[model samples]
Target: MNKVIIDEDIVLKGEHLSIVFGGLKAVEDFNIEIKKGELVGLIGPNGAGKTTAFNLLTGVYKPTSGNIYLNGTNVSRLSPHKRVAKGIARTFQNIRLFKKLSVLDNVKIACNSNMKYSPLTAIFRLPNFWKEEKELDRKAKDILAVFGLNEVEEEYAVNLPYGKQRKLEIARAIATDPKIILLDEPAAGMNPTETEELMETIKIVKEKYDVSILLIEHDMKLVMGICERIIVLNYGKIIASGIPEEIQSNKTVITAYLGEEVE
Candidate 1:
């Protein structure tokens, strides 16, 4: 929040990024630039390198070649944690919550990473430690409250309902206060109502934070409804990039994913 990525308009930019495993190229010549406060969607059929792209962007796997910039700084070589500090956060398709930890603790743990107090202060329970701890708790609760999860703050993460678990993971990601958030299949298992609620929550998140979001999801309705721009990928390469209406009308997208749009 305090520091700025050099380009105030664009939050994330990856140029000609590619990654390979064994003899296969998981992603090839992938490129994208996301503007601040923009909600973009990355969509593809299974194995279209969509998740691989997210992993590379988030530093789970370094690219075989090419550069990635965050806020205008070249961060392709940075470690995952380093990139996180530079304002990149993500949630997985499979809910990656601290299963045993309380819902509130999951968020508190994220806030802990950016704490101002020293280890000695925390170890000794100094005044500064208590001050920071109280602030952290307050901030964590505030974040969960946004998702209507504060009521179950004391329950373990795994004990929550499936949809709530997904929401919690997203909330925890937001707790990191990153400038950009990558979501992988956020609507994977949600029923229609939950998916609808998630769409609304995401809209609220965009309005409240000065953040850009890029998500990879298979749910066409979710992607089409929430994304300002949709990037379509196939065989590890982009087939099209355009607005929701344009993408839906494209013949290639139709054959690859949608059977046929009925009148």
Candidate 2:
């Protein structure tokens, strides 16, 4: 993987983002600024509101107070689909996919949103529909190849082993042509070997797609190994932020998650 040059251009910004549910504050005073091609990680123990932060940025939940800016435009109130149109795409922690669908079909569905054909054209199997379908098929195959998933294009998503399934989810996310992709717990439930493979895949994804990535992951080795910058969250708040080496020895981050600081 080529080394990522963290640029000064900010693509996504969340300023003072906070959300409250009844008496609980799921996230508070959250601020993150991501450069156009940087890969950042969000790490914390479970229920620390790491996913909640993702939700706020992706418009799954309106910030009770604060603002979200994408490419210098305020997108705090835009709908999720609108955000997707603005180059924000994400994969779920739970490995959400069309279980019965072939891997190629899964990616083509993402491409369909960009197709110019009308509903009537699609229903009638018109020329435009066929034209767009062919292009989408090629695009899907290309991205699948980028993720090393092309060989399994005809396989059902549910039939993929756990790690390949994660790769497929990311491929689907990138197929939407996002400028910034949010990945939620991409290393969840993987063994050591699989996690290592995933870390490399993420670097490849960044290079192939040329997109910024903000991920939520608990695997310390994966997070510390791959992320250019790491943000530590605890109880819905960011407690630490820095490069991996700094994070490795930070007392607060260690206390929050690792029980003790590393030597």
Per-prediction RMSD in angstroms? 3.3, 5.0
The sequence of per-residue lDDT tens digits that candidate 1 reaches over residues 160-262 is 9999999998898899999999989887898999989988998898788778999898888779989999999887888899999999999998887754334
Cα error, candidate 2, residue 150 (Å): 1.7
lDDT by residue for model 2 (6-61), tens: 33398888889999999799999999999989999999877889999999999999
Tell me model 1's lDDT, rounded to 2 decimals. Answer: 0.89
Worst lDDT 10-window in candidate 1: 254-263
TM-score of each: 0.94, 0.93
lDDT of each: 0.89, 0.89
- For candidate 1, the TM-score is 0.94
User: Which regions of candidate 1 fall more than 4 Å away from where they truly are?
Assistant: 1-7, 258-263
- Give me the runs in candidate 2 sitting further than 4 Å from their true place: 1-8, 258-263
